[model samples]
Target: MHIHTPACPCFIIPSSMLRKLAIQADGAERQRLLEQLERSAFLRGQRAASGLAAPGLLVAPGVRHRTVYDAHHGTRLPGKLVRTETAAPVTDTAVNEAFDGAGTTYDFYQQILKRNSIDGRGMGIDSSVHYSKRFNNAFWNGRQMVYGDGDGKLFTGFTHALDVIAHELTHGVTQYTVPGGGLVYDGQSGALNESMSDVFGAVVKQWHAKQTVRKADWLIGAGIMTPAVGKALRSMADPGNAKLTWSGDDQPGTMRGYVEGGDVHTNSGIPNHAFYLAAMKLGGHSWDKAAPIWYQALSLLHPDATFADAAQATVKAAELRHGAGSGEAAAVQGAWHEVGVV
Candidate 1:
């Protein structure tokens, strides 16, 4: 005797039919499926939203004027400008260095890439010096760039280095473009974002200083840090090493060993290494070849792009802007592969 199992007509749902049922389902069983569906849908929404958030609101276009304020070393309580009467007069060294660096960053976008300002609008470039007593870092606080007067033991003043200022300000540029919603600050994507800033920061310095690839120091934050420490904040050429031996390793040497969990600042070394390799291979001023490709990629590509995505975008941009077989394209391809971006 053969026992025939009858198919439950209601349960005989086709794979495609199930989707329709899932959408139309109601009551307890439907609610259960919908909950699962809602969770998945929410996750997707998050990913989509992640791609759209502006890193920071754009201030304006074209580098404008600089306004230096004195934060007075206190985290809270607004401070006044360092007028001669209010505080020690703004030192000539501080004024000139800050002016030149901000100018170069402005010119970099204006002359080369034609970006008006951090947001493609003529945003006034504001820089505040003597931010806090013994503060150790400089940052682009969404509105403007703020520099700290280093602890004097670990850092002098952020304004001391043209590249350091450029680096901080470029963070605003990154904010306006991809924004990354602070999510990209981790993993390979975060590393690439960090490296992009370093790439632009170094290029701004080299372009202004007229340094070729060979002459460029390939170090970020070279002068801001204290002399007692052996190296700069980071080294593009040899990431795992510092300019000064005492500063410890600068970045992760390989992709396999990259620091995970979106540590924006720390994990940036991977892409920094790729930029150095690409610039060196191209054999010229970094701004001349590498900067343009990176800028184009940043502006036109997706915000949540990973290191590999960036590498591929750079390769594509170079090819489209230059030629498929151009030296720039080849360099980008090779550099990404070398850094394990492939």
Candidate 2:
């Protein structure tokens, strides 16, 4: 299938969060965060204008290739090539982390989900680390991965967190898997897009750690942010709980708390919580059943699919993968009900 790639890139950090943090911050830090926010807006415009995928030669299935680059605190993407597959690890922590994280994410999809790569066609993974000075965010810019150093105060760095890397990379997977190019980057559809990444991001992390659903932390972007800022970016287990996540997290886990026009990140908590509920109910390694069911549902979605559409797709996927009236299907249905998606 020819997957239509979307022009817009998906960022791990939401602009709303940046704005909130900026308002609270003072001095140079505030200015830097605001600058990053402006850069993010400019990036959207820049990417929309290009309307092109990451330019590179495609490889066949079963061939794993990952390339890492150093942006050297510049705006240019996929900057100078620093490392490649099979190469020795470099001294730069960000470079090594980017390479290793991509490798692990690639392995998780190939070994567990039976996917070739982000595009399921052995498309080479390209990443750039240290993107601009204290840039404060990471993103999959339609074509390649870009990591920001982040202000040391709030974020230690982006590339070092495995879940963070997987989260950004799964954005690429969603772009290729979903029909109609990709999910629309606004409204409920956009929230679902973010949820998909969060779901697979946590699954990839748990799979790598050999952690079962109960044993898993269920926190996205953990260890990426400083403890003073928050435990993580968001919590799948309990969304909108400031104690579990950060002070500024406004994500709602159920329909009652749903915001009419919330940011994609905020609204994603609904689907994220649903996936967590489904996974916990299944009671096993997430990659075994829950992940596969969700992964299969990707092809069942359209660009503008609603929350109800996704709920139905997941229920159908569980039935198709397991059986009619199977436990998997029931769990998925009940999860959607719990989140009021049905």
Candidate 3:
């Protein structure tokens, strides 16, 4: 129950990953991991500072306001305003990436999903880059986006991958779009939250690339990880890689693989792969068929829904959108069955 507190920072780098990195490192690298752990604690404490705490869906027509700040390697948020929505590009790599990535994500939501912004009310998208020394992470923090430069060992710049940026901001969408101010960020519900971000993250990435389902790499955090980290953060097509290796490239694809407690990041692979299958089987652009079904499922799902609940929701979503016994609905059901969610 403590998982979804308004204060919980929905970190993209799972705590388990930090612990693993800390365990695998030695000497100076070990020291870097320790520093990350310390900084992460402080981030948890300040995550709720966003100031918008209303529950239930609030949709209003606002503007697509975006503000990017530079933490200047410090921990402060909305730090120094380096770029506004109309400002010319600065000479910094992180700033431009943050600004561009946020705009692309906003475009995906507005253009593809037909939602105004994070709140579907044109709520401004705010982001902070270069947070702390070798911070090694990025997150939604319940309000705005916060990014970190990796320790230069296991990962690269968080902004290097537009999917990573879209992934975090989608958390804000997940939090605000649900009843009771979003589902509890724990257990099955929390895993769904993670999967939803991955779902749209993949969608936005594909949409930006103009890639169809067959053409898309179907990997999350693809360019974010350094070549040293064994290739990307997670793979939706094959969960075996994630389950067999500590490097975390894939995840478990069945109900038996569910991480008992609330390991949202690790356990999210099941649903992630389910969506992947649905998209692949449906063929053509993911945003056209799979994304709409999943987006509709997000509204249909109960806040604390289990994997079974999600399977049924998406199946029902497919049936509703594509007809009761249409191929689309069957493919969705088949996708859930492949993941063992059925």
Would you list the C-alpha lDDT of every candidate in the order shown? 0.63, 0.89, 0.80
Best by TM-score: 2
On TM-score, the stronger of 1 and 2 is: 2
What is the lDDT, from 0 to 100, of the residue 16 in candidate 2? 95
Error of 2 at 195 (Å): 0.3
Off by over 4 Å in 3: 1-7, 45-63, 242-250
Across 1-342, the per-residue lDDT of candidate 3 in tens digits comes to: 333333457777777778777887899888888888877777667655543444323334434577888998997776998888778899988889988998899888887788888877777778899998888899887777899998777878798788899889888887777655666667888888888898888889999999999988887887676666756677777765853233644357777776687468888999999999999999999999999898888787666777888889889999999899999999999999988888
What digit string (tens of lDDT, one per residue) describes model 1 on residues 249-321? 5357558657756345556778788888888898878878888888887765455667777878889989988
Please give, for residues 294-334, the per-residue lDDT of candidate 2 as tens digits. Answer: 99999999988889999999999999999999999999999
Best first by TM-score, ranked: 2, 3, 1
**Candidate 3 TM-score, true structure as reference:** 0.91
lDDT of 3 at 30: 84
Give the 10-residue window scoring lowest on summed lDDT in candidate 1.
Answer: 5-14
Model 3 error, position 254 (Å): 1.9
For each candidate, how many residue pairs have backbone atoms clashing (under 3 Å)?
A: 15, 0, 1
- 105 in model 3: Cα distance from truth in Å? 0.9
Number of the predicted model whose lDDT against the real structure is largest = 2
